[model samples]
Target: MDSVSPWLVILGMAVVTVSTRLIGYWVLGRYQLSSRTQSILEAVPASVLTAIIAPMVLATGLAETLAAIATLLIAWRLPTVVAIVCGVVVVVLMRNVF
Candidate 1:
Protein backbone atom coordinates (compact mmCIF):
# COMPACT_ATOMS: atom_id res chain seq x y z
CA MET A 1 0.00 0.00 0.00
CA ASP A 2 1.24 3.49 -0.85
CA SER A 3 1.59 6.08 1.89
CA VAL A 4 -0.54 9.19 1.36
CA SER A 5 0.19 12.84 2.23
CA PRO A 6 -1.23 14.00 5.58
CA TRP A 7 -2.85 17.05 3.98
CA LEU A 8 -4.50 14.89 1.35
CA VAL A 9 -5.79 12.53 4.03
CA ILE A 10 -7.26 15.43 6.02
CA LEU A 11 -8.87 16.97 2.93
CA GLY A 12 -10.33 13.62 1.90
CA MET A 13 -11.75 13.07 5.39
CA ALA A 14 -13.31 16.54 5.40
CA VAL A 15 -14.86 16.02 1.99
CA VAL A 16 -16.22 12.59 2.99
CA THR A 17 -17.68 13.99 6.21
CA VAL A 18 -19.40 16.90 4.47
CA SER A 19 -20.68 14.65 1.70
CA THR A 20 -22.11 12.17 4.22
CA ARG A 21 -23.91 14.92 6.15
CA LEU A 22 -25.34 16.41 2.97
CA ILE A 23 -26.53 13.02 1.79
CA GLY A 24 -28.08 12.21 5.18
CA TYR A 25 -29.91 15.51 5.35
CA TRP A 26 -31.17 15.16 1.78
CA VAL A 27 -32.44 11.65 2.40
CA LEU A 28 -34.03 12.43 5.77
CA GLY A 29 -35.78 15.43 4.27
CA ARG A 30 -37.54 13.18 1.80
CA TYR A 31 -38.71 10.60 4.33
CA GLN A 32 -40.94 11.03 7.37
CA LEU A 33 -39.78 8.78 10.20
CA SER A 34 -42.16 7.19 12.66
CA SER A 35 -42.54 8.52 16.22
CA ARG A 36 -40.42 5.61 17.48
CA THR A 37 -37.60 6.58 15.18
CA GLN A 38 -37.93 10.24 16.19
CA SER A 39 -37.73 9.29 19.87
CA ILE A 40 -34.62 7.19 19.22
CA LEU A 41 -33.05 10.14 17.42
CA GLU A 42 -33.80 12.37 20.40
CA ALA A 43 -32.04 9.92 22.71
CA VAL A 44 -28.96 9.64 20.50
CA PRO A 45 -26.93 12.30 22.30
CA ALA A 46 -27.47 10.79 25.73
CA SER A 47 -26.83 7.28 24.44
CA VAL A 48 -23.65 8.33 22.71
CA LEU A 49 -22.48 10.23 25.79
CA THR A 50 -23.11 7.24 28.03
CA ALA A 51 -21.27 4.94 25.67
CA ILE A 52 -18.26 7.28 25.67
CA ILE A 53 -18.21 8.24 29.36
CA ALA A 54 -19.03 4.87 30.89
CA PRO A 55 -15.79 3.26 29.77
CA MET A 56 -13.68 6.28 30.68
CA VAL A 57 -15.16 6.36 34.17
CA LEU A 58 -14.62 2.65 34.66
CA ALA A 59 -10.99 2.87 33.56
CA THR A 60 -10.09 6.02 35.55
CA GLY A 61 -11.92 5.30 38.85
CA LEU A 62 -14.34 7.24 41.09
CA ALA A 63 -13.01 10.76 41.63
CA GLU A 64 -12.38 11.69 38.03
CA THR A 65 -15.48 9.77 37.00
CA LEU A 66 -17.63 11.48 39.62
CA ALA A 67 -16.36 14.86 38.50
CA ALA A 68 -17.32 14.08 34.94
CA ILE A 69 -20.71 12.76 35.99
CA ALA A 70 -21.34 15.81 38.14
CA THR A 71 -20.22 18.09 35.37
CA LEU A 72 -22.56 16.45 32.93
CA LEU A 73 -25.46 16.67 35.35
CA ILE A 74 -24.78 20.30 36.17
CA ALA A 75 -24.38 21.15 32.52
CA TRP A 76 -27.69 19.53 31.71
CA ARG A 77 -29.48 21.43 34.48
CA LEU A 78 -27.81 24.81 33.98
CA PRO A 79 -27.34 27.16 31.03
CA THR A 80 -25.30 25.81 28.11
CA VAL A 81 -22.36 28.17 28.62
CA VAL A 82 -22.30 27.67 32.36
CA ALA A 83 -22.45 23.90 31.93
CA ILE A 84 -19.48 23.94 29.56
CA VAL A 85 -17.45 26.16 31.87
CA CYS A 86 -18.28 24.04 34.90
CA GLY A 87 -17.31 20.80 33.18
CA VAL A 88 -14.01 22.25 32.03
CA VAL A 89 -13.28 23.70 35.46
CA VAL A 90 -14.12 20.50 37.27
CA VAL A 91 -12.01 18.36 34.97
CA VAL A 92 -9.04 20.73 35.16
CA LEU A 93 -9.18 21.02 38.94
CA MET A 94 -9.47 17.26 39.33
CA ARG A 95 -6.58 16.62 36.97
CA ASN A 96 -4.35 19.10 38.75
CA VAL A 97 -5.10 17.96 42.29
CA PHE A 98 -5.36 14.22 41.72
Candidate 2:
Protein backbone atom coordinates (compact mmCIF):
# COMPACT_ATOMS: atom_id res chain seq x y z
CA MET A 1 0.00 0.00 0.00
CA ASP A 2 1.24 3.48 -0.88
CA SER A 3 1.08 6.20 1.77
CA VAL A 4 1.14 9.89 0.93
CA SER A 5 3.52 12.20 2.79
CA PRO A 6 1.76 14.77 4.98
CA TRP A 7 3.31 17.72 3.15
CA LEU A 8 2.35 16.29 -0.23
CA VAL A 9 -1.22 15.76 0.97
CA ILE A 10 -1.41 19.34 2.28
CA LEU A 11 0.07 20.72 -0.96
CA GLY A 12 -2.41 18.75 -3.05
CA MET A 13 -5.33 20.00 -0.95
CA ALA A 14 -4.16 23.62 -1.26
CA VAL A 15 -3.80 23.34 -5.03
CA VAL A 16 -7.27 21.83 -5.40
CA THR A 17 -8.86 24.44 -3.12
CA VAL A 18 -7.26 27.39 -4.96
CA SER A 19 -8.11 25.91 -8.33
CA THR A 20 -11.76 25.50 -7.37
CA ARG A 21 -12.01 29.10 -6.13
CA LEU A 22 -10.29 30.48 -9.26
CA ILE A 23 -12.54 28.44 -11.53
CA GLY A 24 -15.67 29.64 -9.74
CA TYR A 25 -14.58 33.28 -9.85
CA TRP A 26 -13.64 33.04 -13.50
CA VAL A 27 -16.98 31.50 -14.46
CA LEU A 28 -18.99 34.01 -12.43
CA GLY A 29 -17.02 37.01 -13.77
CA ARG A 30 -17.54 35.93 -17.37
CA TYR A 31 -21.31 35.87 -17.03
CA GLN A 32 -23.72 38.80 -16.94
CA LEU A 33 -26.11 37.45 -14.37
CA SER A 34 -29.82 38.29 -14.52
CA SER A 35 -31.59 39.97 -11.57
CA ARG A 36 -33.25 36.65 -10.75
CA THR A 37 -29.89 34.93 -10.81
CA GLN A 38 -28.45 37.55 -8.46
CA SER A 39 -31.41 37.09 -6.12
CA ILE A 40 -30.82 33.34 -6.13
CA LEU A 41 -27.14 33.89 -5.43
CA GLU A 42 -28.08 35.98 -2.40
CA ALA A 43 -29.91 32.98 -0.95
CA VAL A 44 -26.95 30.65 -1.49
CA PRO A 45 -25.35 31.23 1.89
CA ALA A 46 -28.58 30.68 3.83
CA SER A 47 -29.44 27.65 1.75
CA VAL A 48 -26.00 26.12 2.31
CA LEU A 49 -26.26 26.79 6.03
CA THR A 50 -29.71 25.21 6.18
CA ALA A 51 -28.51 22.18 4.26
CA ILE A 52 -25.74 21.67 6.83
CA ILE A 53 -27.80 22.35 9.98
CA ALA A 54 -31.06 20.61 9.04
CA PRO A 55 -29.88 17.03 9.22
CA MET A 56 -28.03 17.48 12.52
CA VAL A 57 -31.05 19.21 14.06
CA LEU A 58 -33.42 16.49 12.88
CA ALA A 59 -31.21 13.66 14.12
CA THR A 60 -30.86 15.24 17.56
CA GLY A 61 -34.67 15.64 17.94
CA LEU A 62 -37.02 18.25 19.48
CA ALA A 63 -35.23 19.21 22.70
CA GLU A 64 -31.83 19.75 21.11
CA THR A 65 -33.41 21.45 18.13
CA LEU A 66 -35.33 23.77 20.43
CA ALA A 67 -32.16 24.52 22.36
CA ALA A 68 -30.36 25.38 19.11
CA ILE A 69 -33.24 27.61 18.01
CA ALA A 70 -33.19 29.39 21.36
CA THR A 71 -29.43 29.72 21.08
CA LEU A 72 -29.71 31.30 17.64
CA LEU A 73 -32.38 33.73 18.92
CA ILE A 74 -30.18 34.70 21.83
CA ALA A 75 -27.20 34.99 19.54
CA TRP A 76 -29.11 37.27 17.21
CA ARG A 77 -30.48 39.52 19.99
CA LEU A 78 -27.24 39.79 21.95
CA PRO A 79 -23.55 40.23 21.16
CA THR A 80 -22.43 37.56 18.67
CA VAL A 81 -19.50 36.20 20.70
CA VAL A 82 -21.50 36.13 23.92
CA ALA A 83 -24.40 34.49 22.14
CA ILE A 84 -22.18 31.74 20.76
CA VAL A 85 -20.71 31.09 24.20
CA CYS A 86 -24.18 30.96 25.72
CA GLY A 87 -25.40 28.57 23.04
CA VAL A 88 -22.44 26.25 23.59
CA VAL A 89 -23.05 26.27 27.32
CA VAL A 90 -26.76 25.50 26.91
CA VAL A 91 -26.18 22.63 24.54
CA VAL A 92 -23.45 21.10 26.69
CA LEU A 93 -25.58 21.40 29.83
CA MET A 94 -28.58 19.84 28.11
CA ARG A 95 -26.56 16.95 26.75
CA ASN A 96 -24.92 16.16 30.06
CA VAL A 97 -28.03 16.26 32.28
CA PHE A 98 -30.87 15.27 29.97
Candidate 3:
Protein backbone atom coordinates (compact mmCIF):
# COMPACT_ATOMS: atom_id res chain seq x y z
CA MET A 1 0.00 0.00 0.00
CA ASP A 2 1.15 3.51 -0.79
CA SER A 3 1.93 5.70 2.21
CA VAL A 4 -0.15 8.84 2.80
CA SER A 5 1.63 12.18 2.66
CA PRO A 6 2.02 14.25 5.84
CA TRP A 7 0.76 17.37 4.04
CA LEU A 8 -2.38 15.54 2.99
CA VAL A 9 -3.00 14.48 6.59
CA ILE A 10 -2.53 18.02 7.84
CA LEU A 11 -4.83 19.45 5.19
CA GLY A 12 -7.48 16.89 6.03
CA MET A 13 -7.27 17.77 9.72
CA ALA A 14 -7.52 21.48 8.98
CA VAL A 15 -10.51 20.97 6.77
CA VAL A 16 -12.25 18.89 9.42
CA THR A 17 -11.57 21.41 12.17
CA VAL A 18 -12.86 24.34 10.14
CA SER A 19 -15.89 22.41 8.95
CA THR A 20 -16.80 21.42 12.50
CA ARG A 21 -16.47 24.97 13.79
CA LEU A 22 -18.56 26.41 10.98
CA ILE A 23 -21.20 23.74 11.33
CA GLY A 24 -21.39 24.30 15.06
CA TYR A 25 -21.78 28.04 14.58
CA TRP A 26 -24.50 27.55 12.01
CA VAL A 27 -26.41 25.11 14.21
CA LEU A 28 -26.06 27.17 17.36
CA GLY A 29 -27.19 30.29 15.52
CA ARG A 30 -30.62 28.73 15.05
CA TYR A 31 -31.14 28.12 18.75
CA GLN A 32 -31.61 30.35 21.79
CA LEU A 33 -29.18 29.09 24.38
CA SER A 34 -29.99 29.49 28.06
CA SER A 35 -27.66 31.51 30.26
CA ARG A 36 -26.56 28.38 32.09
CA THR A 37 -25.76 26.58 28.86
CA GLN A 38 -23.90 29.58 27.50
CA SER A 39 -21.84 29.81 30.65
CA ILE A 40 -20.98 26.11 30.43
CA LEU A 41 -19.96 26.50 26.81
CA GLU A 42 -17.70 29.38 27.76
CA ALA A 43 -15.86 27.10 30.17
CA VAL A 44 -15.17 24.46 27.54
CA PRO A 45 -11.73 25.71 26.60
CA ALA A 46 -10.40 25.63 30.15
CA SER A 47 -11.96 22.23 30.79
CA VAL A 48 -10.48 20.85 27.60
CA LEU A 49 -7.06 22.25 28.52
CA THR A 50 -7.22 20.65 31.95
CA ALA A 51 -8.37 17.33 30.48
CA ILE A 52 -5.38 17.35 28.16
CA ILE A 53 -2.80 18.39 30.76
CA ALA A 54 -4.02 16.60 33.89
CA PRO A 55 -3.05 13.14 32.72
CA MET A 56 0.40 14.23 31.58
CA VAL A 57 1.07 15.89 34.93
CA LEU A 58 -0.20 12.96 36.95
CA ALA A 59 1.49 10.22 34.94
CA THR A 60 4.89 11.77 34.29
CA GLY A 61 8.05 11.91 36.34
CA LEU A 62 8.81 14.07 39.36
CA ALA A 63 10.13 16.86 37.18
CA GLU A 64 6.91 17.13 35.19
CA THR A 65 4.72 16.90 38.30
CA LEU A 66 6.70 19.61 40.07
CA ALA A 67 6.60 21.81 36.98
CA ALA A 68 2.86 21.35 36.66
CA ILE A 69 2.39 22.49 40.25
CA ALA A 70 4.47 25.58 39.66
CA THR A 71 2.65 26.30 36.43
CA LEU A 72 -0.75 25.98 38.10
CA LEU A 73 0.26 28.38 40.85
CA ILE A 74 1.55 30.89 38.34
CA ALA A 75 -1.51 30.44 36.17
CA TRP A 76 -3.77 31.33 39.08
CA ARG A 77 -2.39 34.89 39.24
CA LEU A 78 -0.45 35.54 36.01
CA PRO A 79 -1.19 35.76 32.31
CA THR A 80 -1.40 32.52 30.39
CA VAL A 81 1.64 33.19 28.21
CA VAL A 82 3.75 33.96 31.25
CA ALA A 83 2.58 30.80 32.95
CA ILE A 84 3.44 28.75 29.91
CA VAL A 85 6.92 30.24 29.62
CA CYS A 86 7.47 29.76 33.33
CA GLY A 87 6.29 26.18 33.08
CA VAL A 88 8.76 25.45 30.32
CA VAL A 89 11.56 27.03 32.29
CA VAL A 90 10.64 25.13 35.46
CA VAL A 91 10.40 21.80 33.63
CA VAL A 92 13.78 22.29 31.97
CA LEU A 93 15.39 23.25 35.24
CA MET A 94 13.78 20.40 37.15
CA ARG A 95 14.80 17.89 34.52
CA ASN A 96 18.40 19.01 34.80
CA VAL A 97 18.46 18.98 38.60
CA PHE A 98 16.46 15.83 39.33
Candidate 4:
Protein backbone atom coordinates (compact mmCIF):
# COMPACT_ATOMS: atom_id res chain seq x y z
CA MET A 1 0.00 0.00 0.00
CA ASP A 2 1.09 3.57 -0.66
CA SER A 3 1.82 5.84 2.31
CA VAL A 4 0.78 9.45 2.79
CA SER A 5 1.31 11.89 5.66
CA PRO A 6 -1.72 13.02 7.74
CA TRP A 7 -0.85 16.65 7.01
CA LEU A 8 -0.99 15.95 3.27
CA VAL A 9 -4.45 14.41 3.62
CA ILE A 10 -5.61 17.48 5.57
CA LEU A 11 -4.18 19.81 2.91
CA GLY A 12 -5.89 17.84 0.11
CA MET A 13 -9.26 18.02 1.89
CA ALA A 14 -8.90 21.77 2.42
CA VAL A 15 -8.11 22.27 -1.28
CA VAL A 16 -11.15 20.24 -2.30
CA THR A 17 -13.36 22.26 0.05
CA VAL A 18 -12.16 25.60 -1.31
CA SER A 19 -12.34 24.43 -4.95
CA THR A 20 -15.95 23.20 -4.65
CA ARG A 21 -17.02 26.43 -2.95
CA LEU A 22 -15.40 28.55 -5.67
CA ILE A 23 -17.03 26.47 -8.40
CA GLY A 24 -20.42 26.73 -6.73
CA TYR A 25 -20.11 30.52 -6.36
CA TRP A 26 -18.98 30.84 -9.99
CA VAL A 27 -22.02 28.88 -11.22
CA LEU A 28 -24.48 30.63 -8.91
CA GLY A 29 -23.29 34.11 -9.87
CA ARG A 30 -24.32 33.54 -13.51
CA TYR A 31 -28.03 33.45 -12.61
CA GLN A 32 -30.51 36.31 -12.13
CA LEU A 33 -32.27 35.11 -9.01
CA SER A 34 -36.03 35.48 -8.81
CA SER A 35 -37.81 37.09 -5.83
CA ARG A 36 -39.04 33.69 -4.67
CA THR A 37 -35.56 32.27 -4.87
CA GLN A 38 -34.23 35.18 -2.83
CA SER A 39 -36.90 34.67 -0.20
CA ILE A 40 -36.06 30.95 0.04
CA LEU A 41 -32.39 31.74 0.37
CA GLU A 42 -33.11 34.19 3.21
CA ALA A 43 -35.05 31.53 5.10
CA VAL A 44 -32.36 28.86 4.71
CA PRO A 45 -30.33 29.92 7.77
CA ALA A 46 -33.33 29.86 10.14
CA SER A 47 -34.48 26.53 8.73
CA VAL A 48 -31.05 25.03 9.23
CA LEU A 49 -30.90 26.38 12.80
CA THR A 50 -34.31 24.89 13.59
CA ALA A 51 -33.35 21.54 12.06
CA ILE A 52 -30.28 21.40 14.30
CA ILE A 53 -32.03 22.50 17.53
CA ALA A 54 -35.39 20.72 17.23
CA PRO A 55 -34.01 17.26 17.91
CA MET A 56 -32.02 18.38 20.95
CA VAL A 57 -35.01 20.24 22.39
CA LEU A 58 -37.29 17.26 21.88
CA ALA A 59 -34.95 14.80 23.57
CA THR A 60 -34.14 16.95 26.63
CA GLY A 61 -35.25 16.68 30.24
CA LEU A 62 -37.14 19.38 32.20
CA ALA A 63 -34.17 21.51 33.05
CA GLU A 64 -32.90 21.28 29.48
CA THR A 65 -36.36 22.04 28.05
CA LEU A 66 -36.65 25.14 30.23
CA ALA A 67 -33.09 26.16 29.42
CA ALA A 68 -33.69 25.79 25.70
CA ILE A 69 -36.88 27.84 25.83
CA ALA A 70 -35.20 30.54 27.90
CA THR A 71 -32.30 30.57 25.44
CA LEU A 72 -34.59 30.98 22.47
CA LEU A 73 -36.59 33.77 24.05
CA ILE A 74 -33.49 35.53 25.28
CA ALA A 75 -31.77 35.17 21.94
CA TRP A 76 -34.83 36.56 20.19
CA ARG A 77 -35.03 39.63 22.42
CA LEU A 78 -31.40 40.10 23.50
CA PRO A 79 -27.87 39.36 22.31
CA THR A 80 -26.63 35.87 21.48
CA VAL A 81 -23.94 36.00 24.17
CA VAL A 82 -26.50 36.88 26.83
CA ALA A 83 -28.76 34.09 25.69
CA ILE A 84 -25.97 31.51 25.77
CA VAL A 85 -24.81 32.63 29.17
CA CYS A 86 -28.33 32.56 30.54
CA GLY A 87 -28.85 29.05 29.25
CA VAL A 88 -25.59 27.84 30.75
CA VAL A 89 -26.39 29.43 34.07
CA VAL A 90 -29.84 27.87 34.16
CA VAL A 91 -28.47 24.41 33.37
CA VAL A 92 -25.68 24.65 35.92
CA LEU A 93 -27.96 25.86 38.68
CA MET A 94 -30.58 23.24 37.91
CA ARG A 95 -28.06 20.41 37.77
CA ASN A 96 -26.24 21.44 40.90
CA VAL A 97 -29.00 22.69 43.20
CA PHE A 98 -31.98 20.53 42.32
Model 1 segments beyond 4 Å from truth? Answer: 1-7, 72-84
TM-score of 4: 0.72
All candidates' TM-scores? 0.60, 0.75, 0.69, 0.72
- Per-model C-alpha RMSD: 3.3, 2.5, 3.2, 2.7
Model 1 alpha-carbon miss at residue 64, Å: 2.1
Model 2 alpha-carbon drift over 4 Å, by segment: 1-5, 61-63
Model 1 scores worst on lDDT over the 10 consecutive residues at: 57-66
Q: Relative to the true structure, how large is the alpha-carbon lDDT of every model?
A: 0.80, 0.82, 0.92, 0.85
lDDT of 3 by residue, 1-98 (tens): 27999899999999999998899789888889999989988999999898998877988788999899898899999999999999999999999998
> What order do you get sorting by TM-score, best first?
2, 4, 3, 1
List runs of model 3 lying over 4 Å from the truth: 1-14, 77-82
- Tens digits of per-residue lDDT, candidate 1, 1-98, equal 37898999999999999998799679877888999988988898899888987877767865568677777798777887887777778777888887
- The lDDT ranking, best first, is 3, 4, 2, 1
Which residue runs of candidate 4 sit more than 4 Å off their true CA positions? 76-80
The prediction achieving the highest TM-score against the true structure is: 2
- Cα displacement (Å) at residue 6, model 4: 0.9
* lDDT winner: 3
Residue 61, candidate 2: Cα error in Å is 4.9
